[model samples]
Target: MSLSIYSIDLAKHSFSIHGEDTNGNTLIHKTISRAKVLTFFANLPPAIVGMEACGSSHYWARELTKLGHTAKIMASKYVAPFRTGAKNDLNDAVAICVAVTRPSTRFVKIKSAEQQSILMLHRARDNWVHERTALLNQIRAVMAEFGIIAPKGRHALQANIGHVLEDAENQLPDLARAILADCYDHLLSINQRIADQERCFDMLVNHSNNAQKIMKVAGVGPITATVVIASIGKGEQFDKGRDFAAWLELVPTQYSTGGKPRLGRITKKGDKYLRTLLVHGARAAITNIGNKTDRLSLWCKGLVERRGLKRAIVALAAKNARIIWSLLRNDTEYQVAV
Candidate 1:
């Protein structure tokens, strides 16, 4: 019988696939090279296809979808439980087949080429920032060896570096000065690269209507605005604003039994980069909310007085996540609560 469903365990150069008939009987099982995957699927009757959401899974999903197959990307954890025996490509393929048929299984949203392109820019900027921080920390450690203590914080270190290098009274040797100068020069170059990446983000934000609409919320700047738009796309998968926020892991986690509910801290389960940006934006909004009578600002002050600073900042971020969902899902502008 022609297979009614299929699961693929993907690899760089090869793949393992398991197919099942409508009665849940195994119909076909085989290994094929990566080059043959699409051609094989294109010939097969259109059916449900499942794969783990890793590596090039999104790219494959998009491709398969173009071929009329309903491709579903499952997180590895969810598929792990369905493995019947020892781990192998065959077992993993079978597991994916089983997991995809389950009603409760959560699937990853397939991202477009443009979405992945935006994410590439974000990841590149992150790498440059990490390299910059490492260089700065190395400079700080080298300076400390000479018994010269620069005050804490990046701004302070930048302000004190020139003075430390210029002062002869610090008794810094020539070789040490040369090494530090090299580190400082590299640090400046990395900073310029980071600035250039931010300019790219600004250009993306200027061209995206969704980015502009979301930025109307107080805390969201260009980076946060563009990231949210890139990450969530149209937000059609989420039925409500809270569902979107929960996906971002901004909602409180729950542990309940015996008809009782015990809620714990926020789940922190979604994209770490997006969540961090939202939190940082929230903190900035909190810092700048000085005696403003607007509903958001007034609410922020009251929350600060009640739950204190950190909790209030998180609460605000969660609120912003919900608002972000509303804007993206409905394609509407943000309206302040009056």
Candidate 2:
């Protein structure tokens, strides 16, 4: 029996699909509307379909699955090698078709609607945080021109906002005051939007079994759990827990020759957003806010004492990612050396 493979190059409004049969022949080639992709897939013979994991790839994966096609999403990096010369939709599609049939290629696991939906909140929250930071920076830059200096940190700046606004003795011109006030208002609105998104995240994670299980580990909270789960997707895609942490770029980059290994900074390979969450979560765990003690806290505190706070946070986040993998993969609850 021979298997056929198809590759699709997607765009904003149109896409090109190229197919190659087991006999090394171009079986099909065509361009179609983005809106009509699923309909087209339903009419084609059931075969393996490959598309770059960009934009709305997951949604298409789910739809194709429903239509009985074995669709797989390959990351663009993996598909890039096959594309030679100039890049165009047709050539890209042909390259994808070529790449998918390779013996040792990796494919992204298709995420469910619930996974994507939950992830949307994290994305939305992150955007709002970025907007807030930009707004604060604009306020700071604008105020500095008038000799107004506020302390570092969001809390410090926020605490001084009222004082700055009320202090008439300060040399801030009326125009400066008006601009700062508008920026401050924008910052406040962005913060509120972020808080709202977090609430949605809380609701979604509270409803997930995996999220609850992972959260039992110290340093894993609602946000951390959401980040870890969404970033890793299905844990089975990784060979082991360490692989997941390394994918998160928490592991050190290695330079080794002839069995002598030298590790540098973390490779920083995967989702930076999730990596940041875990690091921050690790910081809180070491803070030990609840005066609660657990194996995770013990590990985090030990690292902090040995490696200092920042490095310790990174180490603990790396450790937490592995523990999360264990919990999710083995289907076990968190325990203190049980």
What are the per-model numbers of colliding residue pairs?
A: 0, 0
Tens-digit lDDT track for model 2 on 220-314?
A: 78887886677565498888989889888899998999999999998667888888888888887777634445655666667677889889878
| Tens digits of per-residue lDDT for model 1, 1-338 | 44399999989987999999898889778889988999999998889999999979999999999999999998999899999889999899999999998898988899999999998899999999888788778889899999988889987897788898889999999999988888878878888999999999899988999998999998899888888877889888888989887888888898999999999998658888999999999999999988789898999999999999999999999999988888888878888877
After the best TM-score superposition of candidate 2, give how far the Cα of residue 163 lies from its true spot, in angstroms.
Answer: 3.1
Task: Go through the candidates in order and give each one's C-alpha lDDT.
Answer: 0.90, 0.82
TM-score for all models, in order of appearance:
0.95, 0.88
Any runs in candidate 1 off by more than 4 Å, and if so which? 1-3
Which residue pairs does candidate 1 place in steric collision?
A: none
